[model samples]
Target: MGTLSGNLQRPVIAASAVCIASISSDFRDKFWPNKSSDTCSSLEQANSFSLPNSLNEPKSSWVSKISVSKLSNLSFVTRIRIPVPDINNLIPVSRSSSVSSFLYSSLTSSHALINAYQSAELVKAAKPASYTYDVSSTPSEVLYRWHLPDPKSIDVTGSSDCSSVKSRTVVVLLGWLGAKQKHLNRYAEWYTSRGYHAITFTFPMSKILSYQVGGKAEQDIQLLVNHLADWLEEDGKNLVFHTFSNTGWLTYGVILEKLQRSDSSLMGRIRGCIVDSAPVAAPDPQVWASGFSAAFLKKNSVATKGVTSEQSATIKEGNKTTVEAKPELTETALLVILKKFFEVVLNIPTVNRRLSDVLGLLTSQQPSCPQLYIYSSADRVIPAGSVESFIDGQRRNGREVRACNFISTPHVDHFRNDPKLYSSQLTQFLDYCVLTCCTSS
Candidate 1:
């Protein structure tokens, strides 16, 4: 009991010291302005206060200083009053009060002043890390974030220190299934810093599922394509595609198909493309199943998975255990065998079937634009061999294609495996594309 009491008192002592130091700084700054530089320096060094471990709670305060009276009179007093909850009301600072109540009240009052300063500091820290805006699309809303290039960096006309600023390119990122906004925001920060407006979105798998087996165009894909096409027509912004995983590839396929069909100026606006761990020509059914399980079952909680209406009804009928068992399939070798069954017996096309057609179109097309393909040799989902083959085909068709192959990097995780290399390579790819686009323009 004595040790605990001593431990508790330590925080009170430290907070009292902080309160004194804060008051001392106020006195020095206000009353001792005429003091010598050496004196002020010494006072500052003396005013530095260390905090105790227990009272290191997040600092919060509404006010820092309150002047009750001017210093001209002895009755005049200037003091910093921090707002803390009334212990009488909250904890009842009396004999009947519990130990927890006393502890809470003591800790609260002790850190009241410092907490105010720290709370203000915390609010400053909590300010938006970056500026972002969102735009809604058909089927589901697409979140669009703008990373405007630094005006000072581009203001070459005013500053002699400025180098030539190339035209800003708008990067469109199509993220994989189940990607959150914060996940893509990190990618956006990279582009914004390097002078690119990055527009990012995720494809709705429910809508993706509505499309036919042969990568057929459905209303969902058409709606997204139309939305993008309209945006393209509004401005002649040089557009670049940064695709992640097979899901992104599927969306890209739909976009390319829409661009090909529409009379809009979108195709010409497309300057370059960068595919990350995608364009899998022939995806294994087991791998696709594993990816789906990871996205729907393992990653999401049961309440939040947004299971289909039919699946939800089925769950009500007592097949919940069977549904729960899907994630377990994520571990078993039987998934590979099941992939063959789904493909051969059920005659179901892999999700990449439609995307593979788009890959073919990219390869066989005239004036094949510069493209950067990033893949890993050890990706379990999208085989590196498929990406290599696609690149080889593109090369044969006289397309300018570059491939960054990493050894043993997992699917859609090359960035996490080595962020420096990933970022540098992406910057290089963007630079090359910018130069080519400028020259072509």
Candidate 2:
């Protein structure tokens, strides 16, 4: 990934803007709104428990050339605990042990959910693979086409070098809904133009249940991650993640299983991940299994017509035509089968976001990769209180996060709201996670 913001707000032709007022009114209106009516009014800076300010930005650290004499106590291992939201369950996720050992032990005392993907077909199915992309493709390939403003619709500019940067040339973009963009062709052109090799990988979206037979999303994740893990192995280059919402659950959790193999050096190259509004937890899976309203099941009964087909049989739960094929179908009934297909298949939850999240903490088989968690008190989806609880939990556990940016934005689209700040914050976080880690090594 490159340092370029890939934001289509100002003309890519223009430079960056230094002064906040110089930024277009549209920019401020979108992200940095006057917080007169904020829900989390207490979001003002509370360093009572915050990461170092220097750590917030990219600080270059070089690989120490220390002699063996300085290697004191190599046997020492550290622990970090990540906070998992519990509905009064109070599950604790620690940072010690391998980071991949993250698991959540419930009062119920079992995690059969993780076993769903542990099958031979699932593992074989998870082998790294690649997808053919049409460079000429436009909105057809973009996941947020409808959400993105006409290129530059969300971005505004002055005359700064938003395109120029001197840090490492890796750019990890967390995509919305697990879709990948030929960012190199569009926003990444600035980095490519400057001779930077920009890499963009698709992230898989995880849901409450695995989508088999009819679940293409999880399959997409397995293949896409397989390809990325292999590529990272071939060329020992570090990269960052630009994750979107719960997709981070699918993106990192699925790879953690494969990365733990002794042969996967690619897993070690993950310098850091950049997440905004990451959903490491999920609602009860039973909610999805038996929670479907009769209306949703009946209206969306257009699952693959072949319940007996092997390819479509995985998701066939007892041939319950409606719910088995497409459980928790949220769309209104008037949509076409194709629209319904897109709604159902494309929205499949190959992995349970909530389950993997708790497991991410408990199953720390590897070192907890450094992360920059950014979210706003303005985030309506995950309450501001969640952020507060998260901060408190992280601090109490002695696991230090590089930084947490408390931006004054509305919701999950932190970057779109305040491109300049969001871009700057993200760039800094990437630098710290990657360049710093590289330097430290």
Candidate 3:
């Protein structure tokens, strides 16, 4: 797409006297039919007069009627002669130097109108087309929505500096296990509003459970990775990964593996990563059970349900009150069943090997970019200790690592419990990443 400044440089064609006369006549007939045709004929006759070679020439220098008819037959004049009623009165009658002045003024006004139309078209062109996917019919399908920054949020200028253009950072939001496109929209909006492109990706639960090493999900992920690589190559944009839960974390690992194998240079464009309630670093049956239980049971799942202050309090005698500490979540029957099921399923030779491969890649092959881990001590799905251990490993690998523990938040509920704090952390991390990128460049 062309820049807004480039569009404004387009030349505007001036309307000729013959074209203006025709448009005036048509407009008057349509809006003021009761008026006599005398005025129309007079306008035509006035414009029919030819200009003298010098201003001192006689006023009797009249052009033939045939010449006026040929001037009216010019292709561009007919094309521009729309019945613009608003400009009917702006049509000058006397064919003096004033006619040239009027053409300049009219073209000037039309230029602004054209520019507004071009700007609207540009914005519309930047919008992504609608996408539809059915996981039931296509189980391997991975769906995503791309959101571009608002044009109004960008500064318009004539400068050629690349930094002055639209934002070159794209934030990829990978949703948790049962997360839907709608669930990730709010997070996408948070990034897009700040002039960055946001791409939200979520996998269906069926696809995740039945995953194979070279299955349909892997095919879909490969395609998505290639798309991101192409985008980075075309625009020289950087990427920041924002993942939720272990499912998203593992998916990020798969993407990293694909990038490392296919195009290693693409990995260098990664600016930062913000992992939310994720990265168990190893395949644990209990963690898998907890994550799947939260995805399946939602609010009813003990692993996901939050304990409030009121629920944790107990009444005392003599009108005195005492605060009782929150109790640990008990293992429900469903969680027990899921844990046992995963214990057997995870032990299968093929499953064990595949999981180990991806986990190994994640632990060692990750890009050396800044990472911010957002988790909570109260999150039952992915333990706080596991996340802390992973962060320490990353630090030991010489990666810039930051961690925030929302002490009482549920799994993947850190942002919802305290959005202000969540947003502040994201903002600070993003700003630092962008500043570092600029300095390095």
Whole-model lDDT values for every prediction: 0.52, 0.36, 0.64
Q: Give the clashing pairs for model 1.
A: 59-115, 59-119, 60-115, 60-116, 61-116
Residue-wise lDDT of candidate 3 within 1-441, one digit each (tens)?
A: 013123323321122355455665664343233435332333223322223334333341222111322222223223343221122233333457744444444433332222222222223233321111111111122376556564444444424233332356778899999998889978987876666767788987656655666877788687568557655654456889999998889889889989989889889989889999988988899999888878877877766654464432322121112322332354477678888978877887777788889989878878888899998766778877899999999889888998887766788988888899999999888878755544355
Show how many residue pairs clash in every candidate, following the order shown.
5, 43, 0
Give me the displacement of residue 377 in model 3, in angstroms: 0.5
TM-score per model over all chains: 0.54, 0.42, 0.63
lDDT, candidate 2, 164-269, per-residue tens: 1212234445453423564223434333333223444443222212334324544555544543443343243445555555444445555556455434556567
Better of 1 and 3 by TM-score: 3
- C-alpha RMSD between model 2 and the true structure: 24.9
Give a tens-digit lDDT track for model 1, residues 192-281.
665555666665443333435433235545544544453343343457888888777766766776688785446777778889887766
What's model 3's TM-score?
Answer: 0.63
Instruction: Specify the highest-TM-score model's number.
Output: 3
lDDT for 121 (candidate 2):
17
